[model samples]
Target: MTSKPAIGIFLSIALAASALWFWQTQTVRPAPAVSFKTIKGNSLELASLKGRPVIVSFWATDCPGCIEEIPHLISLHQQYKSSGLAIIAVSMYYDPPNHVLAIADSKQLPYEVALDPSGTLAQAFGNVQLTPTTFLIDKSGHIILQKVGVFELSDMQQRIEQL
Candidate 1:
């Protein structure tokens, strides 16, 4: 049989861990104001990107679904940038500033990315359950589209053009 002290210690540890997870999960976070800095120190503000339609992709490095959709996102970012579209990839995992930059560099991605390793920003946008959740915002900053499953970037572009 276990000693009483041992059982108490185990319970304490479990409760502490549970509380930490709860705190992390339950807290609310609001969307940031127009701009915020990327982990790498580049100035990033939603307001500065206002003239263009915005695409915010919530992804994680290790998620297969997220990785699979990256090329599509890249295509969207490239094709629409000139048309006043801005794509901001908000990574959910392995989100050090350097990690975000490395992916951008390797892919030769021209748009911007911001990290939210702890899900603060993700929560702000009401995107918490899955990776690769994408939001397409109109130039006026309204969330015009949202995709939770795998989707084609071209299809999104076609829809935007129609808007």
Candidate 2:
């Protein structure tokens, strides 16, 4: 009957939708193995930070969104640093080291701020071409979230806590 055929089609659509949702939710990538040299003259190897949640943010000093997210990033570092959460804010290659250092000092940022003058850091992180791009890697070194522009603080906090 027509009613039976309609019901079958609806079930098929529902099943396909569920499959797509499952696939999307499970798509997580491993973080790239990269090293960072912070403005404070410290070296950090991404592989060494395994078993800890890490936030690798690519930003520029001139980006308004990046500037706007600074406070939130600072808050997160303060809240979670004691709990094995590491945050590295890498300035874009085009941003001069002096400018990055000036901004970091002016803001009194408590976390690591690195300069990417050669763009190797950006290239390691998916060839990052945009400012205010952030990747949240879990304790297992798998990137669970990649967001461009400003991210929701609550959502990021929740994810970090979950990790």
Candidate 3:
């Protein structure tokens, strides 16, 4: 049988290994190199927004959660746009272009809205197939936070403020 001290040493090693793994997984990674074609026919590149905080949100018009988050995103944009925050709402390729345009128009969205017709953008961003997947990128173009669903508004605001 293993002695008590031996077991304790093993447990300590396991805990240290787990902590190291967590730290490596949580390390921030650089954002994907991608460009967006806005609904308004303007072209923008992610690299060009290097010196500002950016939110790249992948969403679909038919997604309930995506629709639910629009107001909050609009509020964030309005609150931070003047402070050098950039937000881009990217509609999934599966979403019809007409629907995307209608929603953007009806909501009077103040941020950039782009369409992913070929689905290349989704594939580039870590094969993002789920709706409402949001990435908060810091000024250096590193992805600081990635959320698969609706994010906590307070936490998001705090992170953005700190960036």
The candidate, 1 or 2, that scores higher on TM-score is: 2
Which runs of model 2 end up more than 4 angstroms from their true locations? Answer: 1-27
TM-score of 3: 0.84
Report the Cα lDDT for candidate 3.
Answer: 0.90
The stretch of ten residues in a row with the least summed lDDT in candidate 1 is 23-32
The residue-by-residue lDDT of candidate 2 on 20-87, one tens digit each, is 65543453898898889999898999999999999999999999999999999999999999999999
lDDT of 1 by residue, 1-163 (tens): 5799899999999999888656433333333464534656687878666657777778766668877988887787777767877778788745566766777788776667777766667777774567777777766666666667666766787866864
lDDT of 3 at 62: 88
With a 3 Å backbone cut-off (N, CA, C), the pairs that clash in candidate 2 are none
- For all predicted structures, in order, the TM-scores are 0.70, 0.83, 0.84
Ranking by lDDT: 3, 2, 1
Please give the ranking of all candidate structures by TM-score, highest first, separated by commas.
Answer: 3, 2, 1
TM-score for candidate 2, residues paired by index: 0.83
Point out where model 1 deviates above 4 Å.
Answer: 1-36, 93-98
Best by TM-score: 3
Residue 84 of model 3 has an lDDT of 94
